[model samples]
Target: ETLVLTYDVIANDGDTDSNTQTVTITITGTNDGPVASGSYEHQIVDGPGADTYDDITGQLRASDPDHEVDELTWTLPDGQGQYGTLTVNPDGSYTYEVDEAAVNGLTDGDNPVDSFTVVVTDPSGASDTRTINISLSGTNDTAEVSGVDEGEVIEAGGGDPGVPTTEGTLLAVDADNPDNRFQPDSGRGSNGYGNFVVDEDGNWSYTLDNDNPEVDALNEGDTLTDTFVVRTEDGTEAQVTITIRGTNDPAVIDGDDSGTVVEAGANGPGEPVAEGTLSSGDVDNPDNVFQLEMGEGDSGYGNFVVDESGNWSYTLDNDNPEVAALNDGDTLTDTFVVRTEDGTETQVTITIRGANDPAVIGGDDTGLVVEDDAENTVGGTLTASDVDNPDNLFEPASGVSNGGYGSFVVDANGNWTYTLDNNNIAVDALYEGETLVDSFVISTADGTSRVVEITILGRDEPEVLHPVHIHRHDSGGDLWVPEVEGFDTGSSRPSGSFDRSLDFVANWLRESSEHEGVVARLWAALKPRDRLVYTSDPFTFNLQAGTFLHTDPGASLVLEATLKSGAPLPGWLYFDRETGEFSGIPPEGYEGEVHIRVVAKDSDGREAQVQFTIKVVDEQEVGMLLEETPQDDTSNEQTLRGKAGFSAQVAAEAGGNDLQAGARALVASLQALEN
Candidate 1:
């Protein structure tokens, strides 16, 4: 500090000399250092490669009372040695340009900001400082994807995030920011699943994108390994390799269900109608085998028979009568359930259509007839029907019989007739307790033929002549006639052989009157009986009692008679008690003369007793066959004796029983001629 003393010299010089006074100066101490009026701070971006502060160095109006501002120099205060190089101008200004390279080189935990002081100093070493903070903050690091801790497993289809699924999502994060985005790097191995989806808020997901060839190629149970990089503005990254595994998918099946087919193999519902294999596809395990279950959920719709290799066919239950009765245009459906190797079931439908079924014949396979003495033979007839065609007819083909088989006749109206043939070979081959069978063929207009078996039944009764000569003489001059109860009042013979007249005689005998002796004698004398005289040993006479010649054993032959009669002609005649019918085969070893006595009563109770004589000839000892009669062939029309003989048609009409009888009669006539 300085004080000035001044003296003024005037031109009226001598007189103004007193006016110019003398000034004395004194030095005083004043504490006036450099004062600053401005404050400033700067922050640099600290970009990756390079950065410019663009004159970030600010100005401070710093001045010193005793020193020129130009004399003042600027000094930078080091704050924790953070301030690097700085240039200050004479105007109390220091331009700051951040070293972007050095700032970027800082470590993660290193201080990213540098704060220092701007000091103004005079030549006297007077100085004042202001804090000018210079901060270096990085732009940002790469975004981080979080929440992908475990491997992801998808159904090979798709998945939703945070929905309790084995599939997961990824979250992107920047430690310095809340808003971030993540995406798979283009070079990453995302081909297996393609590129996953990412939202603006950092959400990751996987979806089925068939449009993408990679996603379309994904199969069930297939696994994929891929890597991706997540990034932010600073080009930092997080390399994450996620394992994505796939799961299975179901198969698809297609069928031809609308086709209609006729039946095969005898044209029945249970038989197969069509043949084919359904088309199927599966991405995973496509080569696996497929099988058709017994039914498609409903068994009643029928079923399918499939081969191990998946060949299939449709069939119906023709064994069911309802199905068998179907007509043309009738339909039967079957459902098929197909199962894959993995046991997945798929259902399909198949149908069958009927057309032109064969004609059906009604009646038993066998026709049974009883030769009731040949006068009233009992037989049956046959009928035919066609469920498919209404105007079908049955025709007669060649038939074989010896006269015991029933006659067969068909009219244009499809009506048929069958008359019993009593004179057949069965008559001779069958004995009193035996049976015989004859076979024949019958046909339909459609060229179909079926074999019909004929069984002739017979029984031995008391020999009944046109003029039966059985009579008994009573004391009152009344004649008692013996009646064969098994013989009907008409020309026919009845069925039952046992007589109820025996009880009448027993009752008569039990109730004795004063003329009881005479009544008793009359009862004893008057009983049903018959007489038979046959001249031969081992006579083969047709008769039937028990079962027909069939594989089944429970067959029966029942006999019922009205004409009261005593025991039927016994001799070779044997009655089956169970069947109440005379047997066909006679008793063994029955020799020459055997008597059969019978007591019979007519419907009027006129009873009498009669006897029969059977002169059995030992067949071995007798000359049963002619010496050279050319073996009596009935199939030929000509005769051995140069005379007209019965034709094969006649022989067949006669049946086996009658054929044998005719042969015997012819033999007898020849014998008579010889004798």
Candidate 2:
């Protein structure tokens, strides 16, 4: 710096004359302080290894107008600035190097300024100071993330957990940022295998989508790795690797679960009813085997069997009611469960088909009835059973007669009835004690048939007689007896000489009775004197006249009998005179009528006599006689067939000599017949 001073000394000379002698004073120029001016600016990037701003050499200038540039000195008040260091020369040229550490320590922003003061001085000690500004422009520092990058997640066990995941913490730092917290929007990333997410605090998780086919196909003990990148807001990324471990999978089943077979060869101890094969699949265990909870299994209607190879069979139990009752075209079902060693199960079903079984007809096939019984019908119940069909029906021929002997009827319920035609010629032709079996075919709906027999026994219809009552007085007198007093009018009788004797006896009875009523009554009581008998059968009779004769109450009476012609009884005839019971068997050669007369007497000398006849005939003659007689006359009666050769001894003590002799003679006759 230079200075010039001018002083007017005329005042000091103090006089006009002194003004003529004016003083001239001159001062020499001296060096002055330099003026420091001008501003310095440079860009400083923040971070390690950043470049320094050295262009301030001419940017900060100071000059000395009164002093030489060499005499002027430029000095920095402090070499160290808040963000860098400064250096200067006498010419005011300076260099500034921004501290890398100081720039890094500066609060992060778009661009910041660091200013420091520098001074320039001359030899006179005058100085000037200027501010040096350094603009700090930050360089983006690489954001770093650090943490455990590996994670492990196990595959879902049987699909229980749908997603497998693992979590870890990631730490991030950015030297150029005031806030190091991650931004969720840019902090998460995913790859083909899984997704990864990170929070502001750098907590991260990797989740595997197990539903993916690639992941699901994994086998036990097999592993997979999923890589995902967790990034910071500045685009810095870190990898999180997730390892997926697999577990055992359940077994699967295939093939048909149902089958069918015939029951014929599949029942009892026979072969299996149905057969099937099963298949299982397990990627984790390729050699999986089937498991049976028990050695043998029951399928409700049958037995079930299965092997480790998944071969299964069902056997029907013959004793099971449902299986046994199966009919042709009928079906029965049996269900059972088959399992795998891994506890997988499938339901197996078996259907059994049926075959026809013959229907059985049971119960009484033989029936019995007597021809002479009030109802001469023979019948019995029938039973039928079928294993296949519960309801049984008789054939259409039921309720119809196949033979003339009887009509046989059957119902759907297996009940049957056989009615004998007693009046049929074939039935009537049956001899006494003979049996005729009426057989007919009975059948089931299936065309199975059996013969049913009805036994019809022939029985003789013995003659039933209505006796005639004759009242007698106590007085002793001659009494006349009707010839056939107690004979049944329903009986068949022979004609001829026997009729003549009956007429004679009727006249005698009419002479004694006298009254018209008595005559009519005697006529009704009179049986024909002739009787017909089969030569094959023996015959017997009683006089039946004592009922019509009258005698004294205290008198002893005896009966005397002979042929109507006063002939003795036939050789075949045996008589008990006291009681007048006659029994005889006619010889085959003798087939004719024999006349008989019976007389009764008492101690009072009263006597009565009646005559009757018996005729013997062969079977053919008897048939002819039956035909000649009216059906109504013979329908209700049959000829008496008696056991032959019965005799009785009598002691006679009658009042009259003739009666006593007759009694003795009758006794002798009976005794001789006995021999």
Candidate 3:
């Protein structure tokens, strides 16, 4: 069992021997940890004071070979709350918020300083630390006062003290050391000085009174002077001067030294008196003397004042009614004249108005008569006579007719009578009882004239009677029956029948009436037995569907009539039996075929006859074709041909046949026939 393994030993060492062996060895590797670099320290000084705490911020970077190390953490070994709060971020950044209470704990002195330490730790538990210093220093807290002058003074009534005075005390101080103090030096007090006080805010105050001895003693052309001194707590001072002067004013009036007086021979009851002047005198000024005062009266007395040179004048009172009424014939007695203290005179005038008497004249009545029998005669002449003048004549020499009598004439004596030619007659009636009134003037010896009216009564030949008639017809060409009729018939008549006839015609011719646009022919005719009166000649005849008759003008008559298409016919005609003349109007509704016959009598009883025929047609149908055509050149040269007849043919020819070829040929044929 004790066999030991051995190798054969070779002499030359080609072979190796086997033996038991024991060995010892060692192995080592590199270590990698966070290495902090670029770490620096900084400090922040407390504002203007001793410092007990320091606050700072800085960058800390660290690196490690091992992947497990991600960031470094910052710390303060003395703890945060003791000095202030320290904040560390994962990016290896750090901040220090120094405690204000800690900062105040430092002594209040110049160049006060404080210190602190900051530590930073890495993830590997490695840490680094640095120290920072903070310093505080004291500064000035006072202001300097300046710009104030010394030994200046201002008057008692000077303006604001803040402004520079003519004489004033200036104040100043050193502002840098926090204490404000001033003292008076060169300009302490002079003329303008009184008492001044300085406020804590560095403002100075000074007051002046009007009742001050210096101000009260200032009279016209006098001046007052004073000085003021302004000082601060620091002994700085300024000065200003004040001045006051007086002004002159005009003397005031204390009492009335002027009076007024009435002018001599210018004062009277109910009479116009000239105004008296006022007088006044100044004590020392001659030019101011004799100042005039205003007067009180109906006169314009205020204008009687003297000028600056002491000259004066008086004004009269013309407003008095009694004085205004005075004329050359009257005179004022015992009138009193007054004067002002300065002495001025005026005169009054008095007069009486004249009397007047009127003259008179008289007249008498005169008479005259006609050649006819006195008992049968209706009137005679009446004349007027003036006792003052026989040749006095009358105006309006002709007298008007009264009660249907003829006109009369007035003679130079105011006599009026009817003409002989118009006197009593047989066949021609005359006015039996008539009168005429006229006016005449009678002259007097004084060349004045008086007017009188004279009325004359007389009779002239009776008026002859004239006759009128009206009639109508129906549209059927038959006589029209009258709804109302007149009966008078005579030889002579008023010639205004046409005027009355037109009134009747207008009634039926209205746009809304049945006879609108109907053909109406007016006719006037005379019979062989009826004589034509020269004055009664017919001027115009108006036909309507009515009948009228009269012995004179203005009589209304209605005719009996019928209408066939709104036109009156012949049945409405009427004849006056005595004059043997006819007149009538057609019916309002007459139309279609119409036949009219009329017989008229003139003023001389002469009659005439007339007859007419008419056919009624529609106005719209007649002109319709004219409105619708184009009327171009080609159409204008073409003649129209159709059953519509000549009217259409003329229209087509005027249109020049511009219609279609067929229409043109037809129109040409029609035009040939028409031509």
TM-score of each: 0.37, 0.41, 0.21
How does candidate 3 score on lDDT? 0.34
**Would you list the C-alpha lDDT of every candidate in the order shown?**
0.43, 0.58, 0.34
Ranking by TM-score: 2, 1, 3
What TM-score number comes out for model 2?
A: 0.41
Error (Å) of candidate 1 at residue 638 is 12
| TM accuracy, model 3 | 0.21
- Per-residue lDDT tens digits for candidate 2, residues 289-347, read 88854333345777777888888887777666667677667887778888876666788
Worst 10 residues of 3 by lDDT: 501-510
Lowest-scoring 10 consecutive residues by lDDT in candidate 1?
501-510
TM-score, candidate 1, is 0.37
Which sections of candidate 1 miss by over 4 Å? 1-189, 196-207, 211-230, 236-247, 250-281, 286-288, 291-308, 311-317, 343-675
Residue 176 lDDT (model 1): 43
Tens digit of lDDT per residue, candidate 1, span 1-675?
565545454334565454444455565666578877675756655443333345365676787888777878887654233434465665766666555445544434444556667778888788898776676666543345566534453444422221112334556544444435543333323554434443444344444333344443456556666555545433445544555555444556565533344553233333445566655565554644676354421445345665544566665555444455555568766566667654445655666655445666665446665555544332334556765444446664333232224456544344444455444323422334444444445555543445455555656544321211112223322212123112122221122222221111001111222421223111111112222323342333322211122111122222222211122355445644343333333455554554433232323322322223434444544433112222224563213221122111212121222111112111112110000
Q: Of the candidates numbered 1 and 3, which has the greater lDDT value?
A: 1
The best-first sequence of candidates by lDDT reads 2, 1, 3
lDDT of 3 at 69: 40
What tens digits encode model 3's per-residue C-alpha lDDT throughout 1-675? 133344443344345755544433333434445565663544443343333444567565666654344555655554354445666555656676777645443322534444555555655566655554444443332223454333323333222232223322233433222234554234323554344444454445444444455543443456555555555553434444445453221222222222332221211332222332323332222313333444433232223433433344434333333333333243332222223222332222212221111113334432223323353223233333322233344443553321122345545543444432223121012124433332233333223334333333444423232211222224322111112211211221122222221111011111212421222222121111111111212222233212222222322322222221112334544444444344544344444444433433334332223333333333212322122121223543423211112222323221332211111112222111000
